[model samples]
Target: MLDYLFAALLGVIEGITEWLPISSTGHLILADEFIHMSTSDAFKEMFDVVIQFGAILAVVVIFWSKLWPFRINRDACGSGVSGLVDRYCRKDVWDMWFHVLVAIVPSAVIGLPLDDWMTEHLHNPPVVSAMLILYGVFFLLMESTVGKRRPQVRRIGQINYRMALFIGLFQFLALVPGTSRSGATILGAMLIGCSRTVAAEFTFFLAVPTMAGASLVKVVKFLADGGGFSGSEVGILLTGCAVAFAVSMLCIRFLMNYVKKHNFKVFGWYRIGLGALVLAYFYLLKPAL
Candidate 1:
């Protein structure tokens, strides 16, 4: 029962930080430091990665109309494969998914080799702290330079594959804990000339595949390592997933609406503050506490 409660708390943390450009990994790590769930270290690590399935599913459910790929308006003009394509999938939507596929390739290629190494070496509070501060600085610097000027790509439709690939390259930076995948992609889109909302929406679309695949891989590895869950552990995981999905729905809606009128510098500042706090907890307060 205590584990179930802790899992719910973690789920709320995951859902809120997961999409807010504040690194979910950083917050989750920090939370675990204090919350102290009675799970093995290995289970906790795998739990953090696999629970992202819930958050990404929120994105999929919210954006189903845009992401369904099979949904199309009926229009009869052409009389061939083009017509069938139009009837089944809108050309631009197909193109958007194609671009998303292209964008994920860089991370997929680079992350595969480094994932094991990073899990072995860099998964720690200090590393997460450094990345949080680093990306926070990036957001502040970017906002200062760009200053919400009229954007070249105001709509997702305006983003070409070239731009998508550029954003994906930026996303590769998120392999570092606390870099925030959405944060990197949003910054990249802005750098390459996308408006705030457009950048964010594209990031949402990008997360579906990226996170889903990542979660699946984590599950596979955990199983291969002969990781087994007791009834309580399984219950905890399910509770976390369900709570994460619910919280993510609200978080996504709030962020989408918030960006229409504001930028992410607030989240940037929040990350910096959280990073500093994490450092303080580990260094200044650990001895006393």
Candidate 2:
């Protein structure tokens, strides 16, 4: 009962924090530490990967129209038409699709090999603290230097393959525990001249493929390793997924509107403060471990 309850709590946290520039993995690690939710290695690993699916589904549900526009099949036109019937084909949407592919390739290539080793051995509280602080500093600097938001690249459609590739390279940094995938990717886009709103939205879209693929890969590996989930365990899993999806829907709606009027400096400050607090709690407040 306790484990199930904790899993639900963690899932809600993941959904709410995952899309934000804040580091969801970092928060998860911290929550586990504070709550003492210990588990077998296989189950622990599986929980981390599976919970992410909830967040990924939220993006798919929210952006279905943009991702898969209603395009009528021209070949279905049989009324003696010389050419294919007109459909909702936008050259820009196709181009954006191509760019998203370009952006996903780099992280997929680099992250697959390192994921197990990092999650198994390198997931530590001190590392999370350092990452939170370091990325917090980067966010602060990025917001100050790139204060002049550009208007040319307003939407994902405007992003070129080269920019996508650049963002992919930056995303590899997020393989570190504390550096957030969204945070790293957004900074990459902003550095390459994408506006804040564009960078944030692209991060949300890129996550659909990137996170889904990663989660699926992990689940496959866990099952291949002969790990079994009980009936009650499956119930807990579903509960977490549903909670995460519900929270993420609300978060996406608010963040899209919020960034239009403000910058990420507020998040940066929050990260710094949270990081420092984590350090103090573990090092000064608590007794030696």
Candidate 3:
């Protein structure tokens, strides 16, 4: 019961933070300091990474129409969950996927090399705090300047290869903890002339592949290392994933509606305050581990 409860709590955190441009990994790391799972350190580490699979699935299901590569056959056009459509030969959708592929390359190239190095040195509260504050400032600055001007590209389809590559370059910054992946891409996209909705939607689309592939790699590596788990541990992992999926669907919908009406400044202020709190808790209130 305790393990299931903890799993559900972690899932709630993941669901709320996952799509909010608010650094879900950073939030989870901080939460783990308080809510230790009844599992091995190895399992806990893998749990945090793999739990993202559930969140990614939310994006896949919620945005299936936009993400599906097929246009419905004229004969098959109907209603809910149109499955009778052509599943292939979607040139426009394929082009969008190509752009998404390009946008993930820089992070894949850079992150693969630095993974161990970052894990060794930068996976601490101090580093996370600094990044949170840094990106908070970045968002506020961008909104004050670039956001006031009318964007050149107001829709995701208007994004070109060069812009996608630039967004990918920005995503490379998210290799650092606390530098939220969606935050980086959204800010990059907005600066490059994507409207608020366009930036957020593109980030959502971009996450489907980037995070799913990442979760798969982590699981594969864990298995390759001869890692094994108890039945109870497996239950905890499943509980977390299932809860996260349910919560993420709600969050993704809320964010989509919220962005259509407001800017991201509230998130910026929240990051700044949270970063300060994390720094203070570690440096002044708590003793070092």
Off by over 4 Å in 3: 74-88
| lDDT tens readout by residue for model 3, 1-289 | 7878999899999988888988988898899789976687778878888888889889999988788887777666565464466765777678889999999999899886787687678778998899889999988999899989988997678998999999999988887889898999999999999998999889989988898878877777788888887899889999999999999999999999998889899999999999999998998889754
lDDT of 3 at 182: 90
- Deviation from native of the Cα of residue 43 in model 2, angstroms: 1.2
Worst 10 residues of 3 by lDDT: 74-83
lDDT of 1 by residue, 113-148 (tens): 799898778779999999999999999998888745
Q: Better model by lDDT, 1 or 3? A: 3
What Cα-based lDDT does every candidate model obtain? 0.87, 0.83, 0.88
What is the alpha-carbon lDDT for the whole of candidate 1? 0.87
Question: Which residue pairs overlap in candidate 3's backbone?
Answer: none
The estimated TM-scores of all candidates read: 0.92, 0.90, 0.94
Would you list the rank order by TM-score, best first?
3, 1, 2
Candidate that would win on TM-score: 3
Candidate 2 lDDT score at position 16? 78
Q: Residue 55 of model 1: what lDDT?
A: 93
